[model samples]
Target chain A: MPTSFPPPTGDAEAEDTLSTLGEFGLIARLNAGRAQPAGTLLGPGDDAAVVAAPDERVVACTDVLVEGVHFRLDWSAPDQVGRKAAAANLADIAAMGAVPTALLVGLACSRDTPVETLTALVDGLWAEAGVVGVGVVGGDVAASPTLVLSVTALGTLEGRAPVTRAGARPGDVLAICGRVGWSAAGLAVLARGFRSPVAVVGAHRVPDPPYAAGPQAAKAGATSMIDISDGLIADLGHVARASGVLLDVRSRAFDVPARLVDVGAALGVDPLQWVLTGGEDHALAATFSGPLPEGWTEIGTVRAGDPAVLVDGRPYEGPPAGWDHFTR
Target chain B: MPTSFPPPTGDAEAEDTLSTLGEFGLIARLNAGRAQPAGTLLGPGDDAAVVAAPDERVVACTDVLVEGVHFRLDWSAPDQVGRKAAAANLADIAAMGAVPTALLVGLACSRDTPVETLTALVDGLWAEAGVVGVGVVGGDVAASPTLVLSVTALGTLEGRAPVTRAGARPGDVLAICGRVGWSAAGLAVLARGFRSPVAVVGAHRVPDPPYAAGPQAAKAGATSMIDISDGLIADLGHVARASGVLLDVRSRAFDVPARLVDVGAALGVDPLQWVLTGGEDHALAATFSGPLPEGWTEIGTVRAGDPAVLVDGRPYEGPPAGWDHFTR
Candidate 1:
């Protein structure tokens, strides 16, 4: 339905480029006929938007995605890029044990960018927000040499306390819900100029974050929670340091997906390495002292020791491991 | 005091670049020793930040600034750019009759960028947010070819209704608070490579938006409100269209400051034109049916007619007006 929307400004031929549609016209086109959730007090087209925060607090986070650095037009469609950008921030809010209320985006692109591309990107943003019953409440667009998207997600805790990284206690079980290594395998396939494995490639393009499992984990007595933006080992390193406990992941605990195993064999790399170190899956990773949530799988335990992450009781020994934006 | 903060890493010489400091290290440097406000329930280093929303609703907005598009490093210091970016979004919140509570920033830049530059920019963001007693709650950094800043501001309405741009009615008086055209004049001087006349040039670097006046105007029964980011006429055009009313500005209403007058005379242009059409001063424009609030100057009136902005009851005749990121 979004794709069927009319061209910006009604003059189909003249609305080819952003410059031709103009900034305000483009905004109107993007905002036209979108339905906001009940939490949206005021939607786009104003200086700011108002969203309900019934719990007396709002959870917020921001994530930046750059063209070529985060995604390439040749590898993923603009809509896919938009979905990935929104998911990155939305997952952060969910990791805080909150239900997303709204999203705000800031986009920078060249003047010559096609109007269709921009509209499709916004369509993706809307589609993702719709999945969680939220809306793209506000945003701004500007001209820049490289395309960049910065998204901020707001959510409500619904009266529960936030599950921070510092709360994990020794003896808590570490668990994860959602796909992990699929994105890394997808990235590998893309880099090698092969795209037949649509599952991995699609995983790389748009993550399927478990939106409800975050609050479900919190309600299930999660001591600490985090979203896997970096690889499992590296991100758990943060939890270990913050909670002042040792986190040990048992490699045998994982039941590797058959597709990833096949891809790994074809590429001559251990699939477990990708499972341990792959990032950007936006998977929900948390520690629980009580029973694991319905969708969660226990893979490790927290122990008393100096802060550090271990695989099978020792330092991980495969792949480059973890992502560092600047250094990488 | 912020300037006195030490280098990104303990080793001053080796930690000069972002690549050397690394993403986590750079984040640590930017967040080190900064005191978060009381409303910040959870600050940075978490998956998401939780901020107090006592009013049961949050007002939010986002704005983007690109390296060569919004500000130039050669023309403005990194700190100034940060302040400008923060101010741009903060003003939007204020225009909604809300008090800013927190800011979330997303930054993208080259790996070779100096750590000092990035930290200084964060200092400016802190400095600006500090003015309204808020904190930089959460953000992300990524690698890109050019520096791009995306700021999302959240605010509370304190149980008051948002004074949107659609409520203006016939016979309402239009008023303005804070400086206008000063930044435009400063831009003119900067374009000519004359950085002197510190007053105007400084205005270009950092806007002094009337933060308090927004709520004040609302309390005084403002019917409609907006902030002047684009030139007055251009921004008012939005209010006019949204409110479905004619807005007429009186030429003699403004008492142009002597500084701006002198600058205009020197540059061989009309200072009044700058006051009418210049932008980025972050001045508040509101319509009221009652008495004007403190610091507010009556400038025009709303009339019954089709949506349009008129200067002296006619179309504006002056230099190219307003800003469009792509077209201009």
Candidate 2:
């Protein structure tokens, strides 16, 4: 356990601190007495840490969540930011059909930021990491205008071959392992100034990717895989382009979650559009050679044609535009 | 080769251009036709990249270099920033006595940023990764106020037990594998609004850690190890505290790097102070149980005493503090 410093209460009082503590002193305070996992041979005190990978193959991915661009403090708490950062990275590892083993986080925030906020952030990170059975091995914290989190996840294949986007064959069947469009719908609810249930807002804050379903799909012979981070059509297009096969989705086959439908109905929007084009759902999208695996629902099929993703045998006419950091 | 939209020639640019390009299109552009080194079984354009960790044990570390806090765009080029980011993360992996194998980067920048700048940044990243025979296997790109680079490095241990910071014992000989204080000197020069030789400024731009020396020290029986990212005294203090030993340094051992001496002379500062308290040199400092390893110079000793670093039997005070992201 790390030594805890009491956080400032209420946002009313302005504090003139941080410079008094200094960076090294604060780092010492933050890194104090945290326990490292058994597989970690070296931890925070060193320049780098060594961990046992066991399977000789490591699955690696990176994601950056920026302030205002990815999330707003007014909408989410510090703990939520930390949880979201870890969740996004871990989802990428799961998408590769690997078990997440460790994580590294890079944080940049303004000076005068409360150390309590940081501790809360770390608590959120640890909370999510605990759920996934991974550890936060190392990180760097610095000052910036707004909070920025760069998370990298490392995973072990456990002797299984990695499922990549390019392995889908022309005749493979398409399946999804988790909920789709909930985050997007949640975002819509937030944007419209509607107070949603804690569960709905929680989905928007820290997405719950179906972590167990990834390795299960790999074991069930998934040919190609990807995380639905950039909407179903957009992410599947990566599979199509990489595998050199067109993917034709039968929209009726998709099993949209009831929560998403409820939110969409209450918010007065097409839930199907969110299912097709809304991103950050982080569900696993994969192609299988045989019958759909447990907890997976068949949604489409890989077709022999030029690489593309089509809805009901036609190009998606409604925006197809997913999240773009720079232009949007 | 990524599809290049005609490079921005004028100042005014259309908004929503990023949204128009879409997330998948941007990722496709970013990942198109990039070559990766061997051992990267699956590279970008996948859910997660797969790298061969061969040794079953891997070294990993991450750091975020934020604009203004970690770097200044007015002072350093985008390529320089890219190289520095890679060097810092790779040095962390190397400091663990592991050979770096791959890197994952996460970048967040504004939409108005030029694509040429992004390409040059990547060019510099590749240039530096080539030095240690490692290549970038994966990354993420998003939008933010200023540029934020988060890099994670992976390395192989090659059957050697990692040299951690907690293993330094009394009577262990302390040695260094690379130059120290050059970066600090360069930073001082930069801060002073003065220019020196290309080498001085170059040190500030791209740090050169002695990559080969890490594994060599491990082979020679290093007991504890860390990278000189912080000033020598400050970083050694970490070893002292972790290992419960006192570290005493003799400054005469730093005669090999004439640049350190020249920069100190030019700046009218004590060269010894820079050697002791300057940082970001990426040098490896390790404690050895036997004679110093090949390519390592004996600079200090671990002794049974209070956990502190002393120079010539006294605590050395200096003008410059070690590099810190916040509260500095």
Model 2 root-mean-square deviation: 3.5
lDDT of 2 by residue, B146-249 (tens): 78888889999888888788899999999998878778878888898877767877798889999888888888889988888878888888889989999999
Off by over 4 Å in 2: A1-21, A24-38, B1-34, B256-262
Candidate 2 DockQ category?
medium
lDDT score for residue A4 of model 1: 24
**Could you list the iRMS of every candidate?**
0.7, 1.9
* TM-score between predicted and true chain B, model 1: 0.96
Give the worst 10-residue stretch by lDDT in candidate 1 chain A: A1-10
TM-scores for the candidates? 0.96, 0.93
Q: What is the CA-based DockQ of model 2?
A: 0.69
